[model samples]
Target: MPYLLLIFVVLFYAGNILTGKAMNDLPPFTIAFFRLLVAFIFLLPIGIKSAWKARNTFREYKGPFLIMTLTGVTFFNTFIYGALQFTTASNVSVLETVIPVVTVVLSALIVKEKLPLIKWTGVALSFLGAVWVVMDGRLLELFSSSWNVGDVIMIGAISCWAIYSIVVKQYMHLFPAYGVLLVMTGMSVLILLPFVAVEWTIGSVPSLGEVKYWIGFLYLGVFPSVIALVFYNRAVERLGASQASVFLNFLPVVTMIGAYVWLGETIKLPEIAGAFIVIAGVILTTRAGTRKKRKSLNYKKTSYN
Candidate 1:
């Protein structure tokens, strides 16, 4: 059942790319702000009382919440939207597959989690696959010309997400999930206000009258922000973070298929091969970590006995 929820989670997230790419005409920051506004509104009725009661708790742990808001809510989707402006959504999703490997490295660096060598090799494989996708299967072209700015921006996006994941693992379990999301969404809306205002002032405004744009807006706000988050949290509770994250390896595959069918984006040979490699690497990395964790837990149980 948790795995089923996770499949939906990946699907909803893939929908984010498809919808966001479709509405690339809107200013990226503007899109982000509105998306958060919609999510805030949707979550308010359900989470407001809880959030109000936990206001002091949030303030007490303002540092982590602030970081979470900035990294996960504010800039991550903004970067994805911005990247879509310069590259295909498929490329964006492919690059995002590196997040798990990056998160593993960050885990080791920041939390001092000791990983075995095989996991490090998985990291290397994932990077190689990501590079292959980024260069569009033309490895030699990397030397001749600069990579797409969109791809570079995706690095920021993934880094923000990886950091956000680590922080959540470290601190967020103490808070009510929905309430925390509400507060963080509210925070993101405020943090993004200035940039959105700038976009408005500069006349990069969204077409408020367009039905398609509104559909995209609501889709982003509801699916990825609310529903997927709820389901993903539940899945994590059931499956554990590492196990749940392994499902994300399917993200690129889903996004590519969606991009092709919905947006008529070409599914090239390199993308296919690269996505396979990245998924293989991520599975290896995450499974290794999970196995090691299980071993440690077993060792602790033995000592206790």
Candidate 2:
């Protein structure tokens, strides 16, 4: 059942890529601002009650909350949307599979969490696969070929997400999940508002009259922002973060299929092979982490008894 919910989560996230590409006419900041604004509005009614109940938690953890909102809500999708402007959706999706691996690395560096040898191996594999895809399998042309700016931007996107994931794992359990998300989304909307105004001054404002743009915004706001996140939080509670994130290995597959079917984008050999490698690496890394966690739990239980 948790797996089923996670599947839907990835599906919704994949739709984010499709819709982001389709809505490329809109400025990235504009899309991010309004999409989050819509989500904030949609979540306000339910989240408000829980938020009030947990007001003390919010007040106590303002720093963590601010970090969560800035990295996860504000910067993540905006980076994705910005990357979408310069890269193929398939490329972006493939690169995004690096998140779990990157998160593990960050966990080790920032939190001083020790990674097992197998986990490090998995990280190396994932990194290699990501670079392979970015280079379009032409590793021989390493220094000579021009890289896609959007693909480079994806690195920042993944880094923001990696930081966000760590913060969530460390602190999100202290607050009501939906309530926290509501506050975060609202914060993101506010943070992006000034940027959107600046963007408008540069003639990057979206056309408000287009039905298609609204449809895209609705999909982005409702599915990826709200529903996927809600379902993902539940899945994480049920399955544990490592186990649940293992399912994201399929995200690239879903996105690539959507890209081919909807946008008529071609999936090249390098991308397919690199995606396979990345999936393998993510599975290895996440499974290794989960096993380590289980071992630690058993050790504590033994010591307690």
Candidate 3:
């Protein structure tokens, strides 16, 4: 599981690098559209087979399935990609680390999940770490022109993702994960088609001359979007959402590495420190949740057996 998660982190960083490269050639939405489009093409066969096998289940979940696809694939990806246009990869990645915090708060409010004190502390620490990283340790710079519109867009994107995560956790028990992903990918592709068409009409279509662009597209479609998601769902199924969220703490580190190698971007000391704090907080939060889950399981077993 650790090895799989490590690979997921690597791919996640690769996706960030790829987005950085592609954002130059195309608008964020167009780039996102194509990324999903490629994944849709690759998974269409499997999705079709799965849909056929689970036709009855799909019929029963038409409404929920639609909502899940819209939120997860369409809204989340579109917003993130668009936000990338205005933000630095480092800023975006660090901010994204707060997604679990958003998810936790939303879960508490919407699903009535109670957070332990330790976990709440961890969440607070993680959020502070994210802020530090976003500000690059120059606390005062946060309010300066050094911050751009992209940062604001990223916050909005994070909110969309947090909402999407909660919605999936709420509805996934009703349908298979792959089935839901397949449907969502398909629907997202359809939603973006007209946008892609408009972009093509307005200007010449983006070319694939640069090797980096193709590499980025392939990495985004196959790894982060497709393969990483498979691993994520499996991890969530086995470990539960609260536990699985800790792994996302690794995302910023991986992204930083990718940025350095692929984009030749330099990382400052504060960024490194912030990443560590975020990871520590994530660990604490997950450990707290695990203990809670065990106690609940023990209570249920005592009552039933």
Identify the leading candidate in terms of lDDT. 1
- lDDT at position 112, candidate 1: 71
Question: Cα RMSD (Å) per model?
Answer: 2.9, 3.1, 2.9
Q: What's model 2's overall lDDT?
A: 0.80
User: Pairing residues by index, what is the TM-score of model 1?
Assistant: 0.86
Q: Give lDDT per model, in order.
A: 0.80, 0.80, 0.70
Model 2 lDDT tens row, 1-305: 77679889889998998899888878899999889988998889989989889999999999998887888789999999999999877678767877767776677788776667886777667666765765678878756756699989999888887777777777878889789889889888888988999999988556689888888888888889988877876766655444455566577777777877887878789878877886777667767766876998999999999
Span of 10 residues, lowest total lDDT, candidate 3? 2-11
The lDDT-based order of candidates, best leading, equals 1, 2, 3
Put down candidate 1 lDDT per residue, 96-120, tens digits, no spaces: 8777677777777886756678877
| lDDT over C-alpha atoms for residue 198 of model 2 | 92
Query: Which sections of candidate 1 miss by over 4 Å?
Result: 1-6, 126-145, 231-249, 265-272, 293-305
* TM-scores for the candidates: 0.86, 0.85, 0.86
Model 3: per-residue lDDT, tens digit, 1-305?
64366456546654654465456557766777777877787777767776667778778877767766776567666666766777766667766777777777787888786677898788777767767765778767666755578777777767876776666666666665566567678778888888888878887787758777666777677666777766765666555554455556556666766777877889889889988887787778767777877999999999999
**Least accurate 10 contiguous residues by lDDT in model 1:** 237-246
The total number of steric clashes, by the backbone 3 Å criterion, in model 1 comes to 0
Counting clashing residue pairs in each candidate, in order, gives 0, 0, 0
Clashes of 3: 0
